[model samples]
Target: MAKNELHIALVGNPNSGKTSLFNALTGLNQKVGNFPGVTVDKKTGSIRLEENFDAELIDLPGTYSLYPRRADEWVAYKVLMGADADIKPDMVLLVADASNLKRNLLFCSQIIDLKIPVVMALTMTDIAAKKDIQIDINGLEAELGIPVVTVNPRKNKGLTELKKVLAQASRMNQNLHARDFMNTKKLAPESVEGVQKLFPQLSEYAAIHYLINHENFPLSDLDQKAVEQVETVNKFNPNKTQAEEILQRYTRIRQIMQQHVVEHGPLEKKMFTEKLDNILLHRTWGYVILLAVLFLLFQSIFWLAQFPMDGIEWLFTKAGGWLSTTLPQAWWSDLIVNGLVAGLSGILVFVPQIMILFGLITVLEDTGYMARISFLSDKLMRKAGLNGKSVMPMISGFACAVPAIMSARNIENKKERLLTILVTPLMSCSARLPVYTILISLVIDDKYYFGFLSVQGLVMMALYFLGTFMALIVSYVMKFFIKIKEKSFFILELPIYRAPRWKNVGITMVEKAKIFVFDAGKVIIMISLLLWFLSSHGPGNRIEKVEQKYALLAQQHPAQADSLQKPLSAEKLQNSYAGILGKAIEPVIEPLGYDWKIGIALITSFAAREVFVGTMATLYSVEETDDNSSLRQKMDAATHEDGSKVYTLPAALSLMVFYVLAMQCMSTLAVVKRETRSWKWPVFQFIYMTGLAYAMSWLTYVIFS
Candidate 1:
């Protein structure tokens, strides 16, 4: 808390355009990290308020009311109530959806009553106008005793006025003298007084929360004991008090709305969103449309990305060739050209696909179709022992499983949440996209059906469908073993359909690409360098012996040297340390149509699934070649000891199947451990996923071979 700095908390209901506002105000200044001691994301950004005064805007998680239900809601509640030590706001900037004024006002009133300097930014006014509802901003401001400004953050409208109001509100000392939205003292007088005595800094409304959620607060042991004693002595009924408070707040809210708002009677013609939902939410057509959407999405990944991918691969290939020829032939030069460039080229070539996939998903989310996906899948999810809420995390898993697993905390039912966490990794993430793309390219042709649909794209879609199908099957079976049962229900609010924000979509694509390149790139480079060292040098004098033998043979038979070079290099690599390590586990993976080289990939890729491609690049680069070939070219031309093709259709498909099911990521396992609060679940996850991968891969090879 700097003397001249202001800490403003941004609070809002879920999907109330709060995030848009945060992005509008902060732009690229925002950074996301977990809150102290919690896995929940804490978004904070610096905003220039005045010449000498700056403000730190904290975006707390969205919750409906002060009565917190989920972990994220508790986070917001804790921050607003001053229970969070790390973040204490000097003023609160509450974003309220103008269209849903009645419901939004409930939370707004709660904040106003907390005696915090508050400013309300009204959003979705256009939607409200479309619905024949209008709000008088100044009137509402006067009623709530706070500054209310109309803002459209998506268009960056009214932001200057909102900031002006916020600055003015911060300079005022009118918060303590503001009108109470609801009289908390009458609801539970004794408990309120008891809590206020324990902590004098809390307002009457905040004291009520302390009485209700004391255990969840960051209270000292003695203070906790005192609060518990107050509860025991006063016989506080939290549920009753909460119900009463809500009723009183709404009663006051209705009076305020009647004075400051106007709405027309229901129209004979339905709203646009409602009309669209009629088809999109249909029982049969909805599922058909979903499949069609997904089919087009995957098809577009290959159709749109192939040219850029080819160009990238060509650039890397040329760079490697130039470096290999221009630089003096040395071990370091080989490491640079063969090891580093090759490994990077493997992962960087698939950037277009990753960007397209995330961009499309973000489009779905922004357009409000993502929620419909949850609603549509609720029935099937229930059959699989999960509810509609699990769909969000499972879909999120397609991007990365770490955050996806963390999001399972939103599911209230312990069994369903646990089941969702356990099975979510089966969703083929973007990390697996490179592996799937390369393998499908190797085995499946690029021929198009009906002049539009791609065969390779169909195979890619099949892999995703396979993973999702298996996740459901696994959840269904595992439901019976884990015996915890709690009743669950799905109540979803589908936001109005809107055009996708292209700017936001672009930002997401760039950010995701950066994460893939930088975060995953680090691991890939480290493994590549280590793989280079191991494959270049061997145990004992085996590598030297092989080299010496090749030199003598080449000298004795000068004309045949060119023909013998491939075998000489091959023999040398076979005796290298990497080859020895790969050969050690070759027998186990052999049944799945994998050789020692693929075995090496499997071992290294446990660090991350995307590392599989980098591992391949490194291994192939270490094998001396005459031409500067891309990783795909190297893999396509690879052969076994008997000259049999290594990446046959059956082998490539088997490898894809293995990655689709295997728990190959250490980070995912670690996140599961943290979420489940035990190592047992992650251990079990590793065993089951690995066993499933092995058994299924073996079957895939046997059936297809």
Candidate 2:
């Protein structure tokens, strides 16, 4: 038999620091896309050692076994078998967390028995050491006939040794080159990169659909040759199953590991984790700690963002003034200043707020505290019969629901993942904060309750609590329909706490915030500009007549009009196109405690709920709000056309209830649609949420009136 070049695939469990190792080896040169039609993210990068010679590393999705359990696992297994690719791997780099070595080696043994050259990156060695579990790499290598390399990728340890070993392995591949292309042809160097780019992907859940493509997997030896190999040595083992090829792999790994590796010390963490988890996981105490953490998270979002947000606001406010002055005050200028500039600036202003949140979440995750949160929440989640893994996404829903839903792939159970995705939106995402703030400001008094919770603040907190309560109620109801035959295992590995990696945290915060600001900012900017231009220029005599009346009034009582302002122009009568629009919509919105100006704010705010404050400011014709002058003060002083109080208690209460229940933000809907891979769910979500808001607000109005 002619020898051929060997190809080794790198595989591991999720969060096993596999990507960290990949990144360290091939810094900044990583390419990411999807694994075919499935939304499972694929990232691949290669390392070049000294000369033109190189080792092509295929970083496969983290999976529990070689068994095709989930859509992601199927792709990973398909790629390794080369069954679908017309090429097969010659070897494998079985990276596993040393702390969780027992479960990790299950995949390694499967690869080894397949007759592939095996090398293992014993990642998180430091974590294992902290837990007082020492692995003898030489002993492991000798036992398995493969090298065992210990690595602390996060700390950049063992990188030099890893490079030396990879270079050596590449030469070994040269000897494996064959005479014919069929068996094991020498892989074309150029095509190696091309093949790496072509990630093994199948069409959607066709990989998982039982009623549809259950036989969709690429041909396997076990399917055709299992009966022929049933000799005395290969007697049928009860643990093995044909359902997904994972059980045999698991059985073999456990058998091999039983020969080596010893268990030591208690399973408890001795450091900050112990102290933290003790309070954090307590039945009652844990929830209180969670609330405390949330308080800091939300409070910081408002308080810490003040300086940066204000600075950005001022810069944008100045830019708008410059635009109005720099360009001709014609239709083009109106579009630029009102539609484009105004929209763009309003969105850019929120950058600081998104950054602050991104930073806090980065620190929380890199420190590995999020995993423990899942452990702490298992009981509570299971009360609704949700998977323990659902807790992370639910907590992440506090940050944003789109990603929380996208992340449900890590959840094994199909029903649990779907329910998590469905209910995650009920967790008050950052998008809802804008609506909550506006409604609270309009209705709830800012007066403190016994020196602490301001009624306005209390209203904001209630909105958050209501959203969380809403998720639980939905999950509780969904629990009856979902069938979970396999009990979820909360086998989360709490990595040893290290000092916060500020460099990594800073980069992550910047990346996340950049993505948020760039995407949502573009949408909001266009919306703001369009809304501005629409408000600035109108088509009819009604608008022209108001402008003529205002112009005449201004000429006669220019001083009266100058001193007539309460630091906000939008609240004034017909001076703003937005104000005029608000007035026009007032007859319909009056019962909701919203004047024409509030009506205008609500209309524009649909682009993003947070745009309410900015829209109100623009409509009010103010550059900024100060302590001596705020949007609430401007709104409170405004009068209806009949000279009645524009913002009465009933109207304010109705608006608050409306904002709390309504689906006003478009970005959230876009993300939900994308995550569900269907518009049906998001459409249903929007209709139900809006219906709920309308009904609740109507009830509040009737009762209060």
Candidate 3:
């Protein structure tokens, strides 16, 4: 690659606006994936420099210092240490928050000691100014011997200057003065020199890091032994060296800050964040406020999505009706109208609800209240054998368990992180919404509880609570069995509250909706097509026999043929391949108030929970000739062989409770395998959740029956 076609590593602390800056620089030119052999998200984007040169920017995970305490932080450390060959950067773009420069400088100084070329992009300058603080950029640059560009990525400021600085810094033949920031040679000269002799290319700081993290770094056995010998000869204690080095670095940082920065405001005055936290983080009222927020979120998801959902359903119903009459009455027509159309409608109708839930979550995250939630839920989380950070993933689990399980990488303790991943799927993701909605509408009355609150809304809230309460109970039980020796701790940074960036929130909503539609929709559509075929054809000519019998009846009673058509179609369905499988499982699920029709839906819907609605739609469409009726309408009119109602209150409620606890999604299992890196956990997770769902559902059925 040319010098101008450089690779820049974007590194920073958590919540330091590093991601915002990256979005500004890259715009829509970015892709997210996992790093090689790890589940940590590796984000890369491209930007044009001066209309001719292009740069690839890698956004590494956020961290506090060179020493890593977690999996993600270790990625950042490895990349900066040149231990990662796949992502060696020509230059580092260190993003720092001006408002918290003192803490941010700790990581910045550590990066500078790595001997790589770096340009500082200082963000949050406006916030610092609002607090009556002033930073002399020229003085800090001269002191640190690097270029510093103050920027507000949210406002799209200083980006041009940032690119120009990056271009100049990348082309420098002579390296930047890395030791001018902090000299580790002064802390442990003998150990550093001894390790440097072995590596030959390592800087003094790199040599020191190698000594401290030799176990973690990628090194040959011979080189590792040599490093260990040096450590033994020098009597180098890793902990003591780290503490002394941090103290010395801070002493130097204070002198630099005093000379180059100024604060005009009183340091002891309470800021707006503290004042808001006084109430938002109150001991008694904090939990109440959190509950209120969750109630509003769930209420808005249901209320705001109702109209769009109705519109989508109406549109699909009209389309299906038109296809039924307009298309030639053939098997392919049935596939398109009853299979593809029905399945697509089933997935699309839930997009509005998914978008709303994710959009609200993005806003909560942007305003930094998400962190406060972690803080508030810390005590409760610990009682469930997790720390505060586990709450964020659990909350995110409400959106989807796949990413929620991935988000547990931040939890340092092995036991707590594993527990969080195991219980997160029980939080009732949006995939279950369609199942809940169709079942609730079928059985529950939609009346007002206090002349204000909708009964349906209260039930929705109760279902969420049921999932969460079960998750907590499960975690508390698993805590004693999954033994680990590592201690758990929670350290959270509460960001200053600000107006949410609408653009980011909008992007998040659109992205999440797309993932749901495209990723999950593919599996649902394929299964729906296969299901149509399986339900349309059967072995041993049973379908032909049913058709012949119906034909003879039509000739004998022409007037009653119209009524006989439905039963004729039902007879053919019962003999079809799909119906045979449902009948095979009927004995197991019969006590749950389910017939073979509902049994077919339960079997096919193992692909996804939302597919339950589509399965019902297709099955009913195959049996009934009416094309204009909605899914709920068709299901409501369904009956048993004895002409008794199939979907009673007990059955509907039992189904809802079953879905709340069921691990029916194959995609979730795939993700668990990827995150946990073993089929053991996913298999174990499936059996346990399935068994739990069956027991609970049976209990619900018996009580209501």
Score every model by TM-score. 0.87, 0.78, 0.90
lDDT of each: 0.83, 0.64, 0.84
Highest-lDDT candidate: 3
lDDT of 3 by residue, 1-705 (tens): 333378899999999998888888988777777788777888898988766788999999999999888778889999999989799898899999998899889998888888888889999998898787789999999888889999888898999999998877767763766455777887789999999889899988888899999988788999899999999999998999899989988998899889988877566578788899999999989889998997787778778988998899889989999999999989889999978998788678878877887788878988989888889889989999988889878877776675567668778787898899889989988778878887888888889967999888788779989999999999999899887778787888899998787777776677667766776677667766777788799999899999999999999999999878767776787899988999999989888888888788787776667767766765675443334337677788889899988889999888889899989877677767877888988898999888888899999999999
- Per residue, candidate 1 scores C-alpha lDDT tens digits across 381-428 of 999999988987887677677657866876867789999999999999
Give me the overall lDDT of model 1.
0.83
State residue 18's C-alpha deviation in candidate 2, in Å. Answer: 2.3
* lDDT accuracy of residue 21 in candidate 2: 77
TM for candidate 3 is 0.90
For 144-236, candidate 2 gives per-residue lDDT tens digits of 666678877778888788766755765675232122111110212222222223322421111112112224544455532322232223342
The predicted structure with the larger lDDT, 1 or 3, is 3
Decreasing lDDT order of the candidates: 3, 1, 2
Show model 1 residue runs off by greater than 4 Å: 1-4, 173-177, 326-331, 392-418, 429-463, 481-487, 559-565, 593-597, 604-656, 665-683, 700-705
Model 3: number of clashes? 0
